[model samples]
Target: MSKSKTTIAKPSVLSDFKEITKMRLALSVVFSSLAGYLLGVETVDFKTLTLLAFGGYFMVGASNAFNQIIEKDLDALMDRTKNRPIPAGHMSVNTAFIIATLFTILGIGILYTINKQTAMFGAISIFIYTCMYTPLKTKTPIAVFVGAIPGAIPFMLGWVAATNDFGIEPGTLFALQFFWQFPHFWAIGWFLYDDYKKGGFFMLPTGKQDKGTAVQCIMYTIWTILVSIVPVFGFTGRLQLSVVAMVLVLLAGLWMLYYAIGLFKKMTEKAAKQLMLVSVSYITLVQIIYVVDKFIR
Candidate 1:
């Protein structure tokens, strides 16, 4: 239940949850959904956008909460995640479950107010992230691929929510994000290889940060850039980017690829970190450019 309904939790207990939810990550996911909505809609609806943000945050937060609960044991084994609420004993599993349930209800309900498809996709994201991706981490590197499924949904979910269509337009948005996630995630896997190994999570292909991993990252970065430029060709039914947007997005992609290339050359953690930051910047900038280009042109 919401805080208003239950006895107020202790301050530090609340803080435990705030940390566990990964609020910044949740907000970033919401931003992608908002960008998709902006791009899909002919006339912007603030109400729908607000719903998208809130619903997206709650769903992603719920997924994160459940992931933490499931990974509590593994998290305790990893230095980076050892301080998290569940693994640190700052919060009980039951409390986390309640929070996750409440978020799910609120998220799906809010998205349902917009459309059934939106709500369905939101539920799917949570389910896949928590059920499939969370457990797969310890079993195989393919977990990253599984995780990318739900990770890439927000953008397409926004488009579906706005237009109630799951055609080439939304598919293009999904494709762009889906391919972008590999390079971004592999970079993190490259830097945090040892930390993840402590948790028994094999994120890199071949389970090592070597030429194979770097080569895959480069290939996916190329794929991401190519998909981002697809709208410029006017093949996608309902999506079209101005030539200006294509150029800007290409430049951003290259910026990310530069760091990827750096990682390939040095194979150093520092280079991997640079690639991660550049990937984050590239995605955010591309989303902003897509939305802005929608109106200016």
Candidate 2:
């Protein structure tokens, strides 16, 4: 008798983790948190750093998972999101729900170990992102404003995790990110307007790719640039930015603004994509500059 052939199972654990966390997006959120923590803490504790990293991962993961769950149907409609685990049938809705809940609980518990305020912020981010922003995406363009609240929390959450309080330092970090999100997200909305339209998501202020929406994008980009340079005036308490760092950040912001202006003038998908890429680079580089300035100064 011929022996039956055996089939080996593929290694799926890592893939599942990546899918559950939306690792790329989670990493971006974690980077902002790390920058805030580094700026806030005079002396870094390895244990605290580890906890913050893990806590941020879980919190962002939970938010993304819940977002996917809520938008699964819409995801199916958009080419950009049609292949996500839930929408593509790689994961069941029930499984995704349980995973999201578990991650949220774990994230809050870990943050609570650091501080109650951090935990509260983590919970609030999840609540606002999942309950309010997710549903509002299809209803009104104001969802971006609601989403910015949660998006801005991670930056300040890091400072709270380090200091266990809300103060000028954390407030500044929050303000910087809060202003940054509008331009970053609006740039993405501009490029993905057709895709978003297919999914019933209204992301532009004017609900169409018109001068009004482009003008709003330009206004937000200007605000982001202004807030990014605020630290140069020594108004952010302990979160001061050196003149050199401020100049560097300002130059980067101007480059980003240039792309935003190009998008406004051309009103083409390519221009919007360029603006989106530049906006991402601006935020990431600004965070790095802030942390580096904190250490150098």
Candidate 3:
């Protein structure tokens, strides 16, 4: 009986770890960082690439862990977050804190090995996320804006890791990710509006599921597409995109924009969810296209 219980406890612990770190989300962030690194690199260095992947994951994980700790009570109040480790009573706040602290230290240490700029940006992402974004969620809808900063960093963080310099390339990458967040997150805010409200978190710009919010989603989707094509103009230095690549990127953006407009016309939860999924796919495809264009050029 004791041996059987030990096996069950092990799986439970692993599940709790995955939940605390938000494993899927962290991996996605790491992928963005790698894509950025690939776009910036003239020739790949697998060592630095590997380090960036692990470091990026650790940093995002740390931020998420800290977020869960700070929002434990609020998390319990919402269906979307109620099953998280701390809120579910599967892990202690102290244990989560320790894990977060360790991740912070390890992440920064690993990133610093690449360069000071990479580490600095990583640290800033964590600070903005845990200090500013998390608390502001309960106070105002502007939290989404603040949260976008950290959310946008991983892409540019890769460029900095690869080049160890701050330039127009990374800045453009940052802008692309930064603007992309509004539509993506607002779609999430639109569908999950009720769930978020239960936690006192207002994520939409107008703070309601009305025409006003839908309009903003369309507006930002336009802005994201515009920014995405900026590289084709030959003004973003090393970030230039071929005409073919630009056309492909435009098509992908338009695909997402269609869903954004659908949300405006339908104004239903289903439409919002569709926009959210398309926005996610749009960003991922854009990143992959950018990298492929770079090498093929």
Candidate 4:
């Protein structure tokens, strides 16, 4: 009697790369970094800009990969994250860990070649995200605040990479991103409250979606809007936003606020979802406005 042997296939390198990086999220981070670079640089340096883009992607990808690795068990328990590469068995923990370490090293090395501060910030972002924020998610609702620190670093990191120093310009960038994160993340928390609760993650300040959380979202959204327009008044000094840009940004903020208010009034899942979508649009559009304003003014 003869027996046939079964062949096991290996995963493609490209697919593995995408799964580890969470390509879509990485791309979004890269886009924000590009906008920061454009705003920070008075005259475009194609070579430097390219380096920042690649470095930003590598750093953020590593952070996200490590986050998935740490939360693999919780991810499997949550409906929203059950299909993630780590949770779904698309990649092994050891393989993901190796990939994350490689990315962190490569990313920091690339940024260090450009300048030391950029590399330092890259390392800090990874450490805060993976080491502090990942564990805090399961322990406290304030994790969102702690997580926002590293989450908001990419925009400012790009500016520092361009100038190789922290200044009013980078400070302004940091402020804009810092305030924006609260509303943006809260909206997501509101929408995914049930799923997060299931996984023992405390995302909302109240740990329950209600008027208080929605009101906080609205307040933060307003603060972000105010900060976005402050550059127009010359108060930001080197990072001034123009009148046209200010008007455009204010409109976007109002649009986002409308959704936030609607969520407060209705307090329904549909309204929460709408606010979440609007928050995403608001951040993306505001970043574009900042970059375009730099060129126009």
Candidate 5:
């Protein structure tokens, strides 16, 4: 008697690629760069915007791939990241390296076509993220501080992409996002404390989930809001905000701060999770408002 063999289905290449690139997160980062491009350019250049989007994605995508490869074993131990392609054995390390290398070249090359500084920042973001940040995650909580440098570069990268200059305006954009990262990241750290602990990453400022950490979240939220409103007061030449948009952006910031305050008061996982959600919404809304306000006024 002959028996038929059953064939196991493999995961689609698209899903594998998406997981490797972390497409959603990569795309969101690209949106920040896009917002900066829109704000910096007097006239919208669709072609450049399109290139920036692809370049930003590839840069960020490559960064994530390198991070996963570096942390594959650690990722497999954490509940939140255990299913990632590299950690789950769905993809090989060499394959990921190939994809990341190709992405790095394509992304930087595309950004270079716009301007060299833009490409330089993109390359720097990848370097800081993959080299400094990845290795430091297990060493100290300062890894978060190191990570934010690359994390915040996208906002300023857009301005440079448009103007090919690094001055007060791009610096202002950089400051806004840099301070914003503390609260946003700490909120995630608070809620995922145990999971992060399992993965040997201390993300909170105080090295524990405590009042000290919550207080810093509140403090940084305040700093982020203040920096966000600087353009409203006409503090920068490249970026300006109308009174209406200023009000709206402040409202969004307050919404995030409100949750940060909640985390400080209760210090509960639920509070931390809500704070994280609001923080994401606040950044996204603020970026949208900046672009819309620029065109409207």
Candidate 6:
């Protein structure tokens, strides 16, 4: 009986850690940073890449843990978040705070070893996410706009990590991810409108599921697609994409755009969910294509 209890209890503890840190989300953020690093690097340094992966994950994980602590009460009010570690009674706020604090220290320290710019951006991402975005989520829809700042950083952070400089290359990467956030998040807002309302979060621009929201999604999708293709025009300096990669990138964006249009026409929860998934795939595919193009060209 004692052995069984220990075995079962271990998995629960691991699950709580996963919930508190939002493991999947943290990994995806790390992927973006790694992708950015790959794009800017002429010769890969596995040491720096490994540091980036761990440091980026720790940074994002810390932000998420702090966010959960701040929103513990609000999270319990919503179906989606009610099962999180803190709200579900699997972890204490104090414990989460301690974890978050340690992750923040480790994250910043690891990043600082790379360069000042990389560490600075990592610290900035955490501050904006926990201090600004978390608090604003309940008060205004503009929180999404503010939240996009940190969301867009990882991709660009990688470039700075690789080049140790902030230039058109990193700037273009920043612009690409920055514009992509609106449509991606709005689709989530559209689908989870009711759940968000329960937590007093006004996620959509108009705070409702309507054609107006869909129109903005369509508009931002266009902007994201346009920004993505800018590297092919040769103006973005070291971020240039070959014509072949540019065409492939265009097709991927159009695929996402098709789903966005479907959401507009259907105006249904299912359509919104489809758009969200497609947007995720679109970004990941675009990143892969960009890196592949850089190597072949």
Candidate 4 lDDT over residue span 93-136, tens digit each: 99899989899988998889879998998899899999999999
The reply for model 2, stretches above 4 Å from the true place, is 1-13
Instruction: Give residue 2's error in model 4 in angstroms.
Output: 33
- Candidate 3's residue-wise lDDT over 1-297, tens digit each? 124423588887888899899999999999999999999898999999999999999999999999999999999998988878898888999999999999999999999999999999999999999999999999998999999999999999999999999899999999999989998999999999999999999899999999999999999899999999999999998888999999999999999999999999999999999999998889999999999999999
lDDT for each residue of candidate 1 in 1-297, tens digit (9 for 90 to 100): 134412456766667778778888999999999999988987888999999999999999899989998999999998888878887777889988898899999999999998999999999999999999999999999999999999999999999989987899999999999999999999999899999999889899879989999999999999999999999999998788999899999999988888888889999999999999999999999999988888888
- Cα-based TM-score, every candidate: 0.95, 0.95, 0.97, 0.93, 0.96, 0.97
* Residue pairs whose backbone atoms clash in candidate 5: none
TM-score of 5: 0.96
How many backbone clashes does every candidate have?
A: 0, 0, 0, 1, 0, 0
**Residue-level lDDT for 69 in candidate 3:** 98
Q: Report, for every candidate in turn, its global Cα lDDT versus the true structure.
A: 0.90, 0.87, 0.94, 0.84, 0.91, 0.93
Q: lDDT tens string, model 2, 9-118?
A: 24344465587679998989988888888888879987988899999999999999999998899999998888677776667889989989999999999989998999
lDDT of 2: 0.87
Off by over 4 Å in 4: 1-16
- The superposed Cα distance between candidate 6 and the true structure at residue 95, in angstroms, equals 0.8
RMSD of each: 4.0, 4.2, 2.5, 4.2, 3.7, 2.5
Clashing pairs in 3: none
Q: In terms of lDDT, which candidate is strongest?
A: 3
Task: Give lDDT: candidate 1, residue 190.
Answer: 88
In model 6, the clashing pairs are none
Residue 269 error for model 5, in Å? 0.8
Worst 10 residues of 2 by lDDT: 1-10
